[model samples]
Target: MPAERVCAVIPAAGRGTRLGLGIPKIMVEIADGVTVWHVLHERLRPLVEHIHVVMSPEGEGPFRALAAGRIESGAVSVSVQGRPTGMGGAIFGAAPHWDAHGTILVVWGDQAGLSPVTAGRVVEAHEKGLTIPLVPMPDPYVEYELDDDGTLLRVRQSREGDECRPGGLSDVGVFCLSTEGLHEAWTRYLDEAAPGARTGEVNFLPFLPYLSRERGWPLTVVPVTDPDEARGVNTADDLAFARRAHQRWAR
Candidate 1:
């Protein structure tokens, strides 16, 4: 088989109401005039030939203005999500732009402390299969259950009164998906998703178990060495914390 082409997909369409920021959370500046989106793109650029950014319709103009050079140079392409369809929709919106025979690296646009090396590690470890970057979590926000040999068994959501496991791995929103399996899973999700669901969105997590159990897709988990690299900016406090983490990682 020919070398597998890899593309990076960034979902930045969320309104981020909790942050109460006037702008999209991904546009929030983390460093001197450098926003989270810039950091994510800079990190993924070295690992993939093309980067597709999914932004809200209203955020397109600002994002384009911010990434003008990259867009003009064909290094980055932006797609507008007509409405909020959650992360799953954002990924699907950019689906047509992906290479049919290649693999995709789905990284959240608000991810901070992401370095080129870290992004490269995920791609290198994929080995032309499915891979999800995981980080040790003090509390199990969202946990991935794995087999003894490291094969992904299923994903478990945190419940009230649950204690954190000693070495729990949380999904860091970084996924390396094979084009074939992605299409299969995405199609199944759209077909089965109910209208006006609880969150009014299709979360990608719930499908992992279905894919592994029903579809028989081999899933691999790659642990992220620096937990900071998997950190995402949500609330004001999260932004502050991520900024500090980025500064430390940059040094």
Candidate 2:
């Protein structure tokens, strides 16, 4: 069977207050002439049909300027996420720019060093339902729970006050989902779901298990051998770590 058609949505609305950068962290120069935005855009360009970068109103100008070539070439599009409603809002906010009938690949803007090889593997493995790449992190900010038979039961998120143990399976900030499935699930979430206990906003993580257990959607877990691929450039330390990881990966 041929690989399903896919488009990408990048949620970049965060202001990166933790990095202490005046601008969004996605625009920060991770390396000479290369920004965090550049890394993700370049990595995802060849894998999908097009890229939709969802940014805050404040970030539109800079991001558009950075994505000029790809935008001109019709390989990328930009949309605004009016508020910081979290990841779920960001992905759905860009909904109009993408093909609703095709698969959607959502990647967090701060996530860097994603391996093209592993990305390709996840794309190829996404025959149907939801496909996600899982990485083993020493301290998991968000952990996925799977049953003995490798079935995804639920997800525990530390940001939402869930107790997370050490050495857990975490996502690499990449996901492939069927558009129809996402639409239906998101509709249900909006109507019936409550705001996260800690975040006080709609979250995307919990919906994963909701789709699997409650809605009977198939969840495929692809293992990522390298943990560096899950690095999120949120803080100054994270930015430095990403820079170092980029150098090591470059060699």
Candidate 3:
């Protein structure tokens, strides 16, 4: 009931166990004044109608407190992921908030500074019928080298042109899906896969090649230049990086 055109689901349930912090990683303060998830949800709210935040059972308390303090431009809700099923499961937790026939957008809990303008272009791509927003990684790049625990290193996608070529779109954390799109995403990639499966987290990126091959579902990647648009906080370092980027944006 917030915004009619879209809904955004943020999976914030993962423990930042690697961050060595006892609190939920998503709740960690990345800036002088904001948490990573707050920046993410705030920026994402205007592009969609409603925002559903998925938190682990252990996380619901903090997340609720966090959401309660925000001036949500869109309708905001929270759901508890009852188990540690994986990324797919955290995402599936937000399904109840969606109607069976509308569009939904998704981002990770730790992500910040995604450009709403680019998000809008992604929506336009969907209006034209692309199942996924295939955003072209910027020409000059800031690549995030994420690790099992920390972001290992970041290089320009072009700089690593061999593994991730220039002009080759790397999978960023933002995804917009229809209600049917959300269901399809869950069914096509997650349902058959075992719950708690390691690859269950393959909720987004892995689907692209298959989509390109089979359904011809157009994956549109609107061009984005600032690598800040795709920053996701995993460790303290990433949080620091995103915080600095966000400060620059506020100015």
Candidate 4:
């Protein structure tokens, strides 16, 4: 596939209640008087030919206004997620606007620390196949179980007792997937997911284990040396940390 066909899908539909911010989390100013979404778009613009932003209906106007230049240039497109369906639904909604034959770089909208370098690395690693960026966790929290060759086995959400793997890596919600892999994963999710999965949120994490175990899909794991670079702004503390990190990154 042509590199110019590569598209970016940003899932920004969540209402960040944890952050307690009245506005959309991506719209929150992080540094340099620019919103997190602006920084993300800037980082991704040069790497991909097009960007598709998926946001809640209420945030459409502000988001459009903020991204007016890109929209007018036809490099960026927006879609309103009418209902609260989770990340899976958000990406699925944007699928129609993207070229199904091309690859997609999926990034969380609130990942304020994401840098163009890291995003470019993901795109390069994706040339090998499906890729997911993983960051080392200080504590053994939710993490991905990997094979000896760095293939993802499963996503273990808790490592309380017997499940604990000290110094394991966690998923940072950055994924590089071909359109075929994405469609297959979504299809399997709809066919196999039990009722009320992840509280009725059609998440993409679970599909990793299913595809890896059942279909023998090889999942390449790319280590993100700086964990902070993969952090998403979800809580007040997280937002502060992101702001500081962005400042340091900018310098």
Candidate 5:
């Protein structure tokens, strides 16, 4: 059979609360005189067929700026989810429109860290099966901020995902949700889940562990050897550090 179609879903709706930049972290300037994700999308387009961006309800302007003077007048599409709603909600908002038989790539638009080669590597892994981009956080000297049991929890406030793999899988926001798994999760969530009791948000990561258990989905972790190729923008400080790292690595 031919190669599977790659339809990408980029979640760019986060509030960037830690940045205190009064703007979404995705809009932050990096080298090349463009916002960070701009560079990412430039490298990513050649490898994928369609690109869908999920942004905050109030994010149309900044998101549009990221695509300035591009030939992708029709190739890119943007959708806004009403809530700061978790990453899960953004994907759900766009589910009805996603390609059912194609592999769906989920990436954080704020992560301007992938080399074109590394981006191709993710697509290669996706073609194989369920996969996640793993990376050793650059601040190695500081020691990871882990749980009491020494697991690297992605977030402190909502630390819940379990370590199905031994070393506690490192999930860089770049994820490859297989078509089968994506459809399975979408169907189950739409059929069984009630709106969130409080913020009415949906959490997508829950489905990863659940589908892995329920449908024998093989969730595999593909660790990125170069840490700089997998960093994410969360704060102004992180941007500064990554810029330095990017400059060093780019050359």
Candidate 6:
């Protein structure tokens, strides 16, 4: 079979209020002069044809400055989301800038620990359709409710105050989305859904179960060996942990 045409989208519009960072979370330095932008871009470069980063209007300038070399080379591009609409909105905001028909590898910008090998697994698993990498986490930020046969029944967002089951399978913030008819599906989802009760935003995770059970899209969940790969830098403590973990991993 021909190699699957792949592209990547990084929803980086968040202002990092929870992180108490003056800059966008993606721009916060993890290593010496290395931000999450550099980390995610380096890991994804080998697997994707191009990368599109969805930034807030104010974030676009700093991000572009940080990615100047790639921007000039056409390997990276930026799109601005006009408002704080959440992940699904950020993804949808970049729709006009990239190849709409190809499989989209969506990775949250804060997922700095994402390794090239795990990203490759996500790309490889795309042959099974919509692919998601899941990690076993003690206190999952997001949980996947599955049936006996391992079909994903629902996604519970603990951050949004959803009461999730104990010791659940959490997403590692990586997904290979099959984009065929995706716009229509998103439009339908927009019409049928309401903003999250706690966050008050149109979330993207729920769309996975929507695609699986409602739209009949085949969903494949790839189990991640290292739970640390699910590390996301959402707060100051998270950043501190990532710095320490990164140093340890580098040795």
- Considering every candidate listed, which one attains the maximal lDDT? 6
Question: TM-score per candidate, in order?
Answer: 0.88, 0.95, 0.74, 0.90, 0.77, 0.95
RMSD of each: 2.8, 1.5, 7.3, 2.6, 5.5, 1.5
Tens-digit lDDT track of model 1 for 80-185: 9998867777887778888564888888877876667767778888765578878887766677777776566666654322344756888677888888767767
Lowest summed lDDT across 10 adjacent residues in model 1 is found at 155-164
Candidate 2 per-residue lDDT, tens place, 176-206, comes to 8888757767888788777999889978888
lDDT of 4 by residue, 1-251 (tens): 35686899998988888888777888999876789888888888888888999989898898899889999999899999999877878888788877554788889888888867788888877763578888887764567887787656677654222264677887676888777666766776788775343365555666677666776666776778877765789888988898887777778
Q: RMSD to the native, candidate 1?
A: 2.8
The lDDT of model 6 is: 0.85
Relative to the true structure, how large is the alpha-carbon lDDT of every model? Answer: 0.76, 0.84, 0.61, 0.78, 0.65, 0.85
Off by over 4 Å in 2: 1-4
| Regions of model 6 farther than 4 Å from truth | 1-4
What's the residue-level lDDT of 214 in candidate 3? 43
Clashes of 5: 0
Inter-residue clash pairs, candidate 6: none
Across residues 50-152, which tens digit of lDDT does each residue of candidate 3 receive? 7788888888887787778552544688888887666666766667776543676777777675666776666656752333333455442333333343222
Cα displacement (angstroms), candidate 2, residue 243, comes to: 0.8
Which residue pairs in candidate 4 collide?
none
Question: Candidate 5 on 1-251: residue-level lDDT in tens?
Answer: 12337777888888788888777677778776767677667766887777788778667677776665442576678888876768787887787656664777787878777676766777776654567666665333111223354233332112332223323334556777667556656668666654544446455654554555555566555667776564678767778876886677668
Pairs that collide in candidate 5 are none
Q: Cα RMSD (Å) between model 2 and the true structure? A: 1.5
So what's the TM-score on candidate 2?
A: 0.95
